[model samples]
Each structure stands twice: as structure tokens, then as C-alpha cells.
Target: MPQATKLSAPTAAPTPALPVRGQTDHLRLIAEMTREFTASHDYQTIAHSALERITRYIGAEAASLFLLTDNGETLACSACYGPVDITGLRISAKTGVVGRAVQTREGSMVRDVSEDADFGASVDAKTGFTTRSLLVAPLNIGQDCLGAIEIINRVDGDGLFEADDLVLLETLARAAALAINNYRLTEQIVQQERERHELELAAEIQRDLLPQPSSREFPIHGINIPARSVSGDFFDIMTLPDGRIWFNVGDVSGKGMNAALLMAKTSSLFRCLAKSAEHPGQLLNAINSELCETNSRGMFVTMVGGLFDPATGRLTLTNAGHEPPLHFDLRTERFTPIPADGPPLGIMPGIAGSDGYAVTEIDLAGGMLYVFTDGLTEATTFGGGMLGIDGARALIRDHAEESPDIRLKSISGAVKLPGQSLRDDLTLLVVEDMMTARAASMPPPRLEAMSTDGEILRLRVPARPDRLKLIRAAVEQAAKYCEATEAWTFDLTMAVDEACQNIIRHAYGNRPDAGDIVVDFIRRGDCMEVHLMDFAEPVDPSKVKSRDLSEVRPGGLGVHLIKSVCDEAQFVPPPPGIGNLFKLTKRLPSKLQ
Candidate 1:
């Protein structure tokens, strides 16, 4: 019967299905996607191309590609292709089926998503799309999971996503993962470059804002160093038209752009109001009020400002919640701390109250004044210790004899000597009550005559405040020899005393050891001329003018007396190696019949 069942045409053998066609297509899809991923370095472009390809190939209604946030706690949707744009959407990396894929570095298939325990329907609810099925695959390269690629609501009315789809999608996910990482790294480099450029520009602006050593006699110097490219610490030195100097040192609360901007505004205010305000306290009050009006960031500034008169050795100081200043006494070789006068600026409006900020006056004769921010005291060392206030005081006391510039450099070098980079800004301001670097470096003065006019009575004496009476007596005797009237004798004596006092106080910086002054009285036809020479610092020519007569002030009267009493008063170039030569001349009366 088996033989008879018949070969019956042997039933045409079924043709075996070709495996090459399907395999070739899958490989072609991978190759094409790889080319697209490498075409451009832009994150958005790569992400968009990947999402579009996956959504169309998988027959899905929507697909979203997410990358882990910088914090790695959440996933931010980078690209989307679907009924709704979810490019900026964010979701927790631990919340749903997507979380499972990223956590396990595997594939997830959810059919009838409503029935799945881990299926979060929030996205579906948000987009108003009814999701029937979803497939999520981890975008992983080695052990690092970049995030997940999710396809939702398949276009086909299939029962569920197949196992084959998961394997195919994971392969595509690997290529996309690398592209995402490259884009992210490139973006990070670009961001760093942009910040670097901004910092350089800010540094340049800050440099221009700082003061340079313009004065030939003023002994004030300051320096600012930033932890980053921009500094929050700032110091200002301005010479007023009335021969007084205004100086300040300040530290903003933080560092970088915000603090830098605040510092610029604060310093500008100090410069603008310095002329109109008479006292340091008044200037600070105006600055505080102005800063409070626009300081929405709640930042504060700790600062100290002073008005110094080189002519009188008087310094009026006003401190605003800053580190106490150190007054280094040249005679005692010690530092006395000057405490703060009020709270910091920008903390509250009307901080000065009804009377205004408190003012403190101190005589800086035979000493140096130092004001600095907290950075100098709070500089950290590798041993976890800080350069405290006591250490800073000792440093200043040790370098008391050096020039202000040299002393500041020494302090800064010691602060950063640990070789570690600074974590804060450093600022130092120094005003010495001694001859300036220029004067100290100059040789002794010698008498040199320009021309022979008449017989001269010359006298050389120590340039000291105590010897001023002797100078007046000598000048009076000379006036009598010239047959000057009694009234003229009194005016000439007073003028001589004022001139010597100016030399002793301003040019010599109130130093007792400053060189001697030479006074020569010459009687020419119809005129009497006196010449004064000293080996001291030259006075600033721009600061030689008289103050407004209407405005009342304690100092500036010396300049007024010299100009008012003499018919001609001027500064002349000193003999070679000398510091300064001042000339004063008065018209003599005609001989009576």
C-alpha cells in the first residue's frame, strides 16, 4: 500500500526562503544610519536624524530620544518625531519602563501599556495620545548608559512588540549613543571656550580701571589679584584738585561676573562722589544708598575709604564692615588696628541713618596707613591654616621700612607662597607717611645759581617743623635789610614759614630725618626774590592750586598763604640730583625822596 500511495508527482518541493535579502536590508539600514550619525557634529541634527529613521522603520506613531542630564538623575528629551513635539520634556530616570531599560541596560517591551505595572501613562496623558504598545531600548556604550530610545503606539495593529524588534532596535541604539556622547563633549568644550573669552575681556577692563603710579610725591600704592580671571576685590587711588588724596580698598561678597559688575558700579560711585563729598563718611553714605537701590542679588560690599592730607598728616577714615585697617607706626614698629565704623554696603537701605556714617580721624604722622580686604588675612595654606590678622600685622610691621610698592608685593607673595591657587581675591592698599620712592632714590640737593642779580643772604637749615620759627626769624631779618615796611616784613615772615611747613609736611612726608632746606634771599632792583631748595619728593603740579575760598576746610590754607602773600610763587626745576626748588618773589616799594 505504501508503494501504491504513489509518488504522485512527488509533490513539488517547497522552495526554501532566502535569508540573504532580509539580512542585507538590516545591514544596509545600520550602514545608512551610521553614515548619517557621523555626517554632522551638531547634537540636534544627529538626534533628529536618528529619531526620524527609527520611527519610520519600526512602524511607530511616535519616537523620542532622551539623554541623561548632567546630574544623571533625570532624562531630558533631546529629539522627537511624532504627533507631538516633546523635545524639551523631562522625566525621572527611575520612574517607568524607560527607567527599567536604562537601569538594566536591556530592552523593554510593553503590550497593552495600561496593563503593564511599570508603564507610566503620564506622557500619554500629557500628549493626549492613546498608547497601546511601547518598546524601549537602552542607549548604552560599554557600561555607560547614555539614556533610552523609546518608540510608542506602533503603527501596525500588532498584538505586541516582537523579540526581534527589541534586538534590532538595540543595535541602532548603540550607534546613536556614541553620537549623543560626541555631541555632548563637543558642546562642553565650546561652553568652556566661551567662558574663557568672557573672563579675558573682564580682566582687561578691570586692569584699566585700576590706578597707576602717576604722582611724583604721593606714597600710595595698591594691587589686586583675582582667584579666577576676574576679580571681586578692587582698590582705588585718586588725587583731588585740592591736593588731598582719596583712597579705598573693597571686597565684594563673591567672585566672577556678578561680583565684578557690582565692584565696577561701586568703584564708579566712589570716584563720582569723592569730589562733591567732603568727608569719607559722607561719600560712603552716598555709595551705600546708591548700591542698595539696584542690588537685587542681595550681595554686599565690605570697604574702607579715607581722605588724606599730605600737608597736615591728617587722615579721615570710614570703614564699612571691612577687615580692620592696620596702622604701622614707624617709631613703635607695631600695627594698631582701626575697627569698622558701620555695617557693609548694600545690606540695607539708608544704612547711614539720619546723621550719616560714622567718621574716624587719626594723625598719620611718622607712620604708614594700611587698609586691606579679608583675602589677605583669610588666604588658605595646604596645612589647613590661614594667614590670620595677627600674621598680617606682623608682616606689615616687618616690612615697615620698605617702599609701599615693595611692601605690598612682599605681602602678596607670602600669601600665595604655598603654591596652591587662590580661592578668593586679594587686595592691598598702602599709604606711607615718609618720602616717596622717587625722593628716597634721589641724591642730595646742591645750591645752583641761575644768574647774578644782587648780593644774596643764604642760610641752610634742617627741614623740620620745630625749626620753622628759626626760618621765620631769618626771613624777617632779611626783609628789614631790604628796607621793607613793617607790614611787608610781617607778610614776608608768614610766607616763609608757610613755605617751609609745606616742604616739611608734604615734600618730606612728615619725616624727621628728611634732608635740609636751603633758603636764599636776594635783593634785586624793585623786587626781592627768595629761593627754597630741598632733597625731598616733588609736589604734584596739578594739586598746587588753591581751594575754593567759599568752601571752609581745616587744611589747604598753607597753599593759600603762599599764593596770596607773594606777587609770584612757582615751582622750579631743582639742580641735578635734587628733588625740588620752590621760588617766591615780592615787589619792593620805590625809594622815597
Candidate 2:
């Protein structure tokens, strides 16, 4: 049965005024209690003091304060001056004199309790006290009957209980109820602390368990985000030697600690393979073999891995049922996708190998690449409608010409609403081209195999902090060089700004004290791609893995803007801090800046 609320009726009546000598003293006492005790924040302490004070102030032999619990069915004695055991006694708000007054919202007084039908003398019987004049009244505030207050056996000169006495007791009851209510609120606050603490602990553990970033003067990057207190999505970056970079992003099928732990193992193993210099397909095979043996929960991970050559700006990648990444052509100012095949990790590890992997190839021919988990596209609005793939792609196109910060703000701002909660996680990545990046003395490994419309300008630059500006200037210049119209130049300029800033901020993270970054720009026959190679720190894109940005913030704003501004962005981590490549590709003849 649903519990009844305390009387939701008229407000408590003020005590009736009467002509009496001690009335002034009684009023003063009541006022003092209200100002000093009831006004204090602690309610229970004041309640006890109020009853003890009423006993002495009113010249009553005994005083009792009954409080109604939230359910209102029981009125328990909260404080009693005459007898301590009265604290445990319960009164029914339905039948007892106190109950009837509280339920009916009335006040009753029995000058001689034994002669009054409403008076119950059992309390006096238990205490060996004679029946005497008394006052019982409901303690009400607003519409709630908090309980009742009673004064028994007036002393120090009293001819029966006068009307003035009833007035005084009523004043005391009002103050008492307010105090009691505050005490109940405090109790609720104390309980919430425990739950909040646990959530904090869980959130901390989830963050701590993620992969430790690899700080190397190489090319590779990562991102991650937890869906809840713990995350099911993660990524890792490890740079090997010989211009080879290794990185992977993956998401567990479920959420929470178990998925987080599973993500930890996958990330660790994937990063550990940095020593092997394995190709994308080979690495997935090895990891799948391990997961096939250990993934007892039957859960799987949608994963993607890649090996990037900073010198060549070539990314050899393998995808495990993850999203099909975008490939943008700077020359044509058009976009498409580079798809990979294989099941999610742990879904029969050997499945892809038995069937042969479906590999999609694209030339980072001065262009961009983008990869993401379902979280980004699957994020829902407050109205329960998902942003979906079309929304994510449309955002990219709409702001493809805006500044990175503006683009980030636009995408985030598009979803802002009060009091709405995100239903899932969203994670996305963009790899931009850093124009004027040129490095000499490289082997010609089939440049013709790559296709570009003609906006690409590939260069290889030495690793130096001062040279970063040169790369940025070169990109700005390249934008002017390739654009058929001035409008297209501004669009490319924003892409250049975002890509260079990311290479400086995300890749180097403002660590000028460390070392400088290397840059390369590849202008294909069809489109232009800018490549920024750094040997700073590589973040696992998985860190920004799965978060529901649809409703609220689960991560930072940079990557979101990168996705919105550039046609494509891809991260490639090379070995020995050798290659940390940031590729940004913009389709030529694009929208105005």
C-alpha cells in the first residue's frame, strides 16, 4: 500500500490571544525558543531542547513532542521531558487524541484527563502520575501535520488549563514541526554522500585503467572516452622504428567494469605488438587469436589498426567491423570512404583469416581521413531521435570551411539542452594535412598507385620547432595555389589552421621543451593532403572512444571540430618516435570559408 502523506490541509492556526498575566512571559519564552533553538540548522537537537524548555517555561510537570514520519501513519514521540521511554511510544494519527488532532487538523485540551473521552491516561498510569489538566494540539506547517505537542499538569498556579495556555502550546508546536522537517532533510543528504562517493570512485578507476600514452618523437595518435563511470571503448599508440607507426581503436560490446577490464587487456596487447612491426591484418590476426582463447563473456570488440609511414604518408590499416572511415579528395573537393572488413574482435578470432580480410586502400595524397565508433553517430537527442550517420556527415560538410574552434563549438552547441541525459557514448577522430611539409631522400614506392585530382603538394621536412611555422605558411600558400576561386582558399585555410594546431597542441601538447615536429605535404594528381609528422606524444584515439555527446559532454572539443572542419583526418604512429603523422585532406572547389 502506498504510504499516506502527513495531513495536506490548511496551515496551522496561530495560538488564540487571551487576557492573562503570565501570557507575556509565555510569549517571550516561545519567541526565544523560535529565534535561538528552532532557527539553528540542526533540527533534532532543537526539538529536544524545545520540549525540555516547554516543560519548565510553561510550568508544566511534563512535556512531549510527537513527530510524524513521512508516511504519516505513525506519530512517534520525538522528545519528552518527563519520561525518556516515551521516545519509543508510537501514536496512530488515525485514532489517538494526538492522531485525531493531526489527521483532522484540530487542537484539543482536557482539563482533567480522566473525565475526557479523547484523553488516554495510560501514559500517566505507566508513570504513576495522577490525572491532571493537559493540552494536546497538532503541530502543523503549510499543509503537513508534522506531529503534535502536549503539555501536562500545569504547575505554579493554574485554574484548569486556560485558553491562553492553548495559544502558547500551539506557537511552540509550529516551530517544532519546521525544525523536525529540516532534520529529515539532513538525513537524506547524509545518505546521498555514500552513493556519490561510490560513483566518484568508479569514475576514477575507469579513467585510471586506460592506456598510458606513449611519449615518443614519432607519428601515431589516440583518443578515448567512457560511456559511463567506466568505458568500453579504448585506443593505444606505439611508435616503432623504420618510419612505421602502429595504433588501434576498439570498443567492447557492453559497458562497465567488465568491459573496461577487457578493453585494458586489448589495448595493452595491441600496444605491446609495437615491437613486432606487424601489418594491420597480421596484428589483428594475432590479437584475435588471443581473444578467441580468453573472451569467455562472448562479447566482442569493433577494432581498427594501422601502420603509417611518415616518409610516404602511407597508412596500411585493418578494421575489425568498425565504421568505414572517410577519405576526402582535395583536388576534387569530394568525399568517400575507405572500408575494412573482418568481424568485431572475439567474434571467432579466425573468422577473418579463414575468409580473407576485406581491405580498403586510400592514398593520403595530400588529403584527409576520419574514423569513428558508433557512439558519435548513434548519439540521441532529448526527443529520443538519434543524430545518426547523416547528422554526423552533415555536420562535417556544413563546417568543413570553419575554424577548428568554431566548428567544435558549432557541433557541441547544436546539441545543448537543459536537463537532458545522453543515452550512449560518442567518439570521433580527424587526421589533417600539414602543408609545406617536405622531407628529402625518400624511396619512390609507387606514387602512381595513388590517385589525386591535382591539388596535392607532397613535401618532407626536418624535425624542428622553428620549422612548424614554415609548414603552416606553406599550407596557407598551398591553399592559394590550388584553389580555382578565392572562396575555396578560405575553406582550405581553416583546414590548415585546425590541422597545424592539432599537430602542435594534440601531438606536441605545447611541450616546446621536448623537441620539434616534422611535417610533409603530399599533393596528389587529383587532391592535396597535408601531413604533419611529429615525434612528440601519441594519444590512443580510443581514449575519446565512446561517449554520448548527443546530450552532454563526455570529452573535450578539439577532435569534434577537427571532424567538422576537415573532409578527412587520420592518425598514423611510426616507430622510434620516428613518425607521428597528422593528415588533413580537403576536397578542392569546396564551399566558401
Candidate 3:
């Protein structure tokens, strides 16, 4: 419109070129600085060495490297090659010429400090040094500015920094920035690796603190699983000389390393104190007092501790702000929940009061007691739902008939999905009342001769399949002593073999360490009676039904075969200290009698 005033592109200012000698010297100096930076990994060492070389190359009387603090509000002099030794000096990030260079990500050349508004005279005043000229180059990588390098009082001709000096400083700043960045990244990687290794070691130590899995026939069993590299949940079982078992399940308030450390401390205290403490209440009181003395983080522990007498099927429990334990009755298939009675441990020295945590006495008559952390209840199921208390009860019922070891596995496996992270740490414990079950199932003792009266043969052997042959041999010899025919002896031997096989497989759950079996062959009057005894968990006779012979299967035939060969086979009341007593009777021929 207004004659379209001819627009012309403005010509860019030409970059200043260095003299031939000066260019060569700069290239050599850059090469030397690169080699020096590449050879060192220590931050302070590289910074100090580079600062000295840079001051000499730039022909400056003194130089300092300033790095931004983590908060970016202040600048710290990390290294210096100056007479004043300004290392560790601090200043506001926006107060000086060096700050401006870093903030603007550019280089500055001040011919006279008096003419510069950003120059701070305070440092010179404090150190008793006079500053007339200065140059600053920002240490930058891409869009990030780490800090700046400051050079003061040029020693060369004219004693003033020029455009070429600023350019050279900027080039040197880039190399230094790259070296610092690389060092920081490498340090981070090394720190992470070290932390990972330490965590693995800690996990191993934690595992060692837990008791080994108990025998399947034992009255108590427990399991623990961690959500991360470490767990905040723990369980322990220790049997006293009098057959009373001390057991506990605990959960810390938080997670990660802190929680794990607390769990370890609490568990160790329980094990160490429970040995002398007469009851669960007293034991928990002592543990609580100890924790309160050193629990500076305000963390607490929720736990359930119990003292169980297997002989009487009695459990005295103390709950410290933990989830209620479910007492499952085998006969009625119902759960009786025992709720917490006190605040969590570590809250206060006398949180439980003078009497300590209240005790709940329970009679687990032929049933089970289940104690667990909230993690099990909050676990995600395959259906994408949380396994609440009801779900946990269902899992228990489903695996109730299994051995304690197998039952724990089944219950935990249902919620521990593959490739999925758990929401929290999980732990579970079970206390079975085998004594009550044995008492209920045992029949009255018969008024027959004792085993010592007509003990034709008596032998004790480990409950293993390989040891069954010894029982067969002893039975055969006992039949001969009673003057029975070869046919009669063979039949008794086969029956005894089948009976012993049942004891090894069913009574002991085929475990190698499951106590032993004691057999007694007695010839009383006209009848020869054989008695077999085991110390395993009592077997319910009603559940030991013989399968139909018509069905073809690999197993479920031992009981049928034993009953077929004997005239009468039944379970009788065992003597004191015995779990089960099985008797087999056969009337000898008249001639032998």
C-alpha cells in the first residue's frame, strides 16, 4: 500500500576470528582439557585440575567454578584456582555477573567492573582483593544450564577480556559441563546397584530369622510372602520342653526397609522373651515395653501371640490391635472370631495397662485356629476382587482336609497371581488341635492282656515304605511261634504289610521324618492278636472308608486289602502317649490252640 517500502534482509554481524598463533594455542589447550576431563571420574578432582589449567590458558590471574544448588536458589563455588581460596563460598543465584551468565545461558566480557551493574563488590571486600575486569561463561548442555565459570583480572596485554576470550571460555565450559553431567549419571547408576545388592542381602537375612517349616503332624504351621524385595510381616513357632508351643503372627505399620527392620526386631524380641515369659499376655507386655523404648518413628506392630498346650487342646492368646483370629470347628464347620484386645505395640510403654493385654482362652476341640495379616484379606483374586475375610474362610474350608503344609500352599496360591504385584505383605499361621480329635475318635480300652503279657514279637521301625518289610518278617515269625500253618502265616504277613503301608502313607503323610510305628504280635489263648501303634495325627475312622473294588484306580486299595485278609480289623483306644491303636485278630486252628 504505502509504495511497499522495499524490505531488505539485515546482514548478520561477522564472528571475530582469532590470530593464527592464538587459534593453534586454543586448539591445543582444548585437546589437553578434553584428555584431562576424560581421565578422571572424581568431581572435585576434575573441577580443581580443570580450573587451574583454564586460568592459565585464558591468561587470567584467578578463576572459580560456580554450581547451582539442588534448590536452584543459590550458587556454590565448587572449585577455584585463585589467591583467595574462594572454594565453598555461597551467593544468591541472581546477585552477580556469573549468575546472569548462567541464567541467560550466555557468555559475558566486562572490560571494566565499575561499568557493570551485575558485578558484586562484596566478595572482593571480604577477601581483601581488588577486581577491575571479569569474564563469565555459562556451563550448558542443550537447554540445561548447570552454572557458570568466572575469570577475573586478565594478566595479558591491556588487562581486559575481549570477545575472543569469551568465546574460548564458552567452548571450555561445554566440555566441563559434559564431564560433570556424565559423572553425575554414573554416580546415580552405581548408587542404585549398591542399594539393590544390599536389599537382596537383607532379604536373605530375614529369611534366616524365620523358623523352618514344621512337620505336617505338628499342631502349628505358618507361611510368609513379601510384596516387595522385603516384607513387614513375620511368624514364629517354638515348642517348649513340656510340649507347649509358643506361636505368633505380626505385621508392621508401614512397608519397605523401615517396616522390615521393625518386623525383625519385634520377631526377635518375641522369640527371646517368650522362652521365659509364662503366658502370652506377659510376653507381649515385655515386647511392647522394649519397642516403645526405641520406636522413634511412631511406628507400631499389630500382633497375635498364643501359648498352646497340645496335651489339653487349650490356647491362651493375647491380641495387640491385630486382625481377629478365626477358630474353625471341624464338626460344625463354623468360625468363631476372637477380636483384638489391646492397642498395637510401640504406641506407649504401658499401652496394655498394669495387667497387660487381656487374654482370651479358647478350647480348639478337633478344630483349627487361623491367624493372618490384612494383606491376605486385601489380596486381589483372579476375578479382580479383593479376598476379604469371607473369601479367606472359604479358601480355608476348601483345603481343610489337606495336610497343614499343603493347605497353606493351596490357600496362598489362590491369591498370588503370576506376574502381578501384591498390594501388601502377606502372612498366615494355623494351629490344629490333634489331641482333641484323637480323644473324640478313640474307643474305650478293652479289658485284655497287656502287650507285655503275650508279646510273641515286638518291633519298632520308622514310618517309611521301605521299612514295611521288617514288620512282615516279624509277623511271619510270630505266626510260627504260635504253631500256625504256613498258609495262616502267609495271610497274616500280607495283612500286616498292608496295614503298615497304610500307616506310612496316610498316618504320616509319607514324610521321612514322621516319628515311627510300633508293632506288637501277641498270642493269647486261642486267638492271635496283632497291635499297631503310631504317633502321627489321629485319623478319623469314618473318613477312612474303603473304595469300591469295581472302580479301577492306582491307589485307594490298601485299606480294602488289609480288611479282606484279617478275621477282624478295627481301631481301638491307644494307651497313654499314643496317637492311634489298630488291632487285627485271627483265631488259630484248633490243633494249634
Candidate 4:
């Protein structure tokens, strides 16, 4: 291998100084080139124009700008200016004078190509252009060398390159290197911005595809939280025309756009086919066959789909390599896990066998069924440990007494720490057997004396803060009907309002879907008895106590407010189908009695 002679500034041959007019022209040309580089972001156009001006200024026959490829193993001619066009020519970084300049990060001037053992004659032979002398300057920005600029065969002054030419080329190479680097950086930034926008749009579309939150009394409910702008996990709930509810939870194999796309497809397929498909197993088979046709990346989806008949408290489920759904029995407080029975979708058509994925029939029997992606079990808990299956069961057991919507939120929120990202896409779906819960529980007993009093007013509303106003109106009207004074009516209304607030905050955990509240007002001669009822868990009379007035606080005031205005304020025997019954009796004025 032949090595070219490197030229250092201190040892370069000296040349005669240019005249004043010539010096002015050179300065003007360099200024113009710098302005062009700064104004335009196109690398090739600017490089070619600069090469033409450089070749003419140096009185060279041909000039070519070489840039290192991505791998840095070879130099390719990015632009050229001369009679012969060698724009796409490539050569090894160690084989020619131009390569030597870049590798050494210095300039090189060869007076005669034949005398230099480092000269590669293959380019001259291929293009039929004879090269005698050449000047090469490396394109450098600080200590980094990009490539080199090679000027071949000087057309003036005995056809030999001078030292002045090498100096000028090096100065020009710096400007060109800066321009190329800037263009690359700008291009990269634009590409990233575009990708970010697309991801956000995809995320919005995914959200629109999901079902809205159902009412608290509905038997099926679900929640989804993505780790990134998009998620690979998805869940869908669709109610068929025949009253059968179709629900599913799925996990795509990877993350980002590819996984998000697959999630969308699978969710769409379930929604479309589950409406008409008779069984969960056969519906999954159809989706699997459709996905196999276009899944070129070898990706797959693990899903569990089920059809629930609310009338029978029966669920027919089909699992395809997904996490086993946990069935929590409200009566026994036991968990039963139903594991997958087939491979994941998109692996191959009919991989679930001729009958499709195996179906598992479950009798919810007043219990709750939970379907979730691995994101839940793999999440990091506040205790700095992975929430494995045991942790997941604990979350479920803790919140099992709450409404379906609040239960799902509490379970998912337990692992979602503040100021931290999720490990994966989290999705959870719940199916409750409303029939069993209704049949097993009994209605509250009513007080005989108040029940007989003609039923002055009755109102039932959801247990929400917004519904408290309506209850207050009913209380005022009932107090007015009994001919109670303005002061008495105001006190009764305020007392009832505080009672409802306590039910929303304590019994329902402030959850929007926390069942309903029933109020009954009766006129008992000179006294008005108002009964407030809720269907939440039974409250212990010992635990329900008014706080002492000595210590002032924001809360614990509702109970005190209720007791202060009423003659009797206590939990009474509720009517049929009620959980907690609160009774308040206020005496009428002396004239009415």
C-alpha cells in the first residue's frame, strides 16, 4: 500500500503574493460562498455551486467533492464540476490522495501524479481523463473530518498545483462541511416532529374507538391507560341487539406504531364480528384468520373475548394466549383464574383448531370477572416492588366492595404512581353478575308508624353531589306541607343535604357511579319523619358517630349539622331493597300540634 505525503502549514512551499485587486476578488468570492452556504439548507445544490466556483478560482480542469458514506468505510463523490461527470464515483478511504487528506485531517498537494506512489489511476482510466497534478483538502469542522475536495490537473502555470491553491481549498472545504452538517441536522429534526404528530393523531383515534364509561348499574365496564402516546393494549365492550354483552381485552406483541396499529385492527375486528358471531370462540377464529393474511412482521395478539348473558349470570369466554382472567366471588371472597386455551392470534390461520379457540363457561353467580393485560401485573407499586398476581388479587380484594367503575379505577390507580411512567399499556375490564347480587340481598325493613302516614313525598336519585339539590327541594316541600315554620323548613333541608353528602363521600368514595339514594317523607300528625336510604355496604352503627365540636375541622361537620337541627337523627330499619336507612324526625310548631 502506498502512502501520500501529508502537507502541514508550517512546511508548505511559499508562493508569490497576489496583487491588491486579485486579493480583493478572492475575499469577495469567499464571502459570497459563505453567504450561499448559510442561506440554503440543500446540501447537494450548495456543494455543486461551491465546487464550480472553487475549480474556476484555482484554474483547475476538474473538481469533485467527496463525502463519507454512513458506514465511514468509503468516500463517494457527492458533486462534481468539469467536462467529465464523475458525481457518483466511489473509492476506498485509504486508496487515493483525497482519502489520505480526510484520514490525516490535512491538505495534500501532488506536483506530478506519476511521481506519487499513492495515486490511484483507475478513475482516470475509467473516465478517460488524464490527471497529472492535484490538490486535496479535507472538509473539517474542528477535529472531525467529513471527507475531502480534490482538484485535478491545474490548467494554468505549467499545469502544476501551487501551495496557495491548497490553502484556498482548505478554507472553502470548511464552509462546505458546515453546510452539509447543518442540512443533515435540520432534516433529522423535521423527521422527528412529523413522527410525533402522527403518533398523537393515532392516539386520539384509538381513544375514539373505545367505548365510553357505562352507568354504575351496568354489568360491564373497562379502563385503558397507555404508557406512551400510543398503546399496544386495548379493550372493547359492545352490547348486542339480543341483550348479550360482548367484551374483550387484548395485548399486542410489541410497542409503538406497529403495535398500536395491530391493536386498532384487533379491536375493530372484535367489534364488527362480535355483533353477529354467535360464540366467542368462533369470533376469535375469524379475527385470527383475517390478521394472518397481513401480519408480515410476525407479530401476534393475546386476547380474551367473552359473551355474557345478564339474565342467566353465565359467561362464555375464549382465551388466546392471554393472562388468565380472575373471577372474584362476592359471596365466598375467593379468586378463580381461568387460563388461556389456545395460541395467540396472527400466528397462523386456524391455529385454534377446527372448533376455534376453546371456550370456558363460567357462572359468575353474583361474583365479578376481571380481564386485564400484563401491564397491571408487571407494574411497579408504591412499595417499590412488581405487582405480581398476588398483588393484583390484593388490589381486587381491597376494592371489591365498591361499585364496578370505582373498583376498576382503584385497582388500576394503585399501581399508577405519581410522576412515573407505566411499564406497559394498562387495560382492565370487569363483568358483574347483577342477577345474583339482587337475588341474594334483601330489602331494608320500614318503620310501621311512618309507613302508614300517607307517603307525602318519595324521590330516588343517583348518589352524586349534583343530585343533592333535588333532594333538598323535596325536603322543603314536605316540611311546608306539614305547615312547619320557615326556620323549621330551612333546618330540615340543610340536615338532609348534609346526610346525602356523607353518603357520596363515605359510602361511595366520591365515585360518580356510586349507586343511588332513595328518600321518603311522611307526615306523622305533628311530626315529619324523613327517611334517606342507600344501597351501599351495611354501615355499623358504632362507626357512625358525630365528631366532638371542640376540635374544628373541614370534615366531620355533616354529622354534627344533621344532629343539631333534628329532634331524632339515627340509622333506622331501611325499607325493602335498601342497604342503609337514615331517619330524621322534627317536631312541628305548637299551633300545628
- Predictions ranked by TM-score, top down? 3, 4, 1, 2
Per-residue C-alpha lDDT of model 1 across residues 259-309, encoded as one tens digit per residue: 998998899999999989989999999999999899967899999999987
lDDT-best of 1 and 4: 4
Q: Candidate 4 — which pairs collide?
A: 443-576, 443-577, 444-574, 444-575, 445-574
| Predictions: Cα RMSD each | 16.8, 16.4, 14.0, 13.7
Q: What ranges in model 1 sit over 4 Å off?
A: 1-41, 56-62, 67-76, 82-105, 110-134, 141-146, 152-162, 213-216, 296-298, 332-334, 380-390, 434-593
TM-scores of the candidates are 0.63, 0.48, 0.71, 0.69
Cα deviation of 141 in candidate 1 (Å)? Answer: 5.1
The models' CA-based lDDT, in order, is 0.78, 0.62, 0.83, 0.83
TM-score of the candidate numbered 3? Answer: 0.71
Model 4 earns a TM-score of 0.69
Q: Could you give candidate 4's per-residue lDDT for residues 247-301 as a string of tens digits?
A: 9999999999999999999999898888778899989999999999998688999
lDDT of 2 by residue, 1-593 (tens): 11111111112111222334375777787677767553566655676677767766666666778877759888888777653237767767677577778888777788777687877767655654554688887878888788898877665455257786787777777766665666667668867887667666766765665545433222333345445666777666555766455666777888766777777788777877656745778778888888888887788888877766666666777888898777655434467876757778787857886744554545665455556677667776545677776777777666654433344345544443445434554445444442323234344222221223442444344443465566556666676556435555555555555555555666666566444454444565445666656556566656632334585763455566656656787764332223355676756664364
Off by over 4 Å in 4: 1-34, 128-132, 155-157, 436-593
Off by over 4 Å in 3: 1-39, 436-593
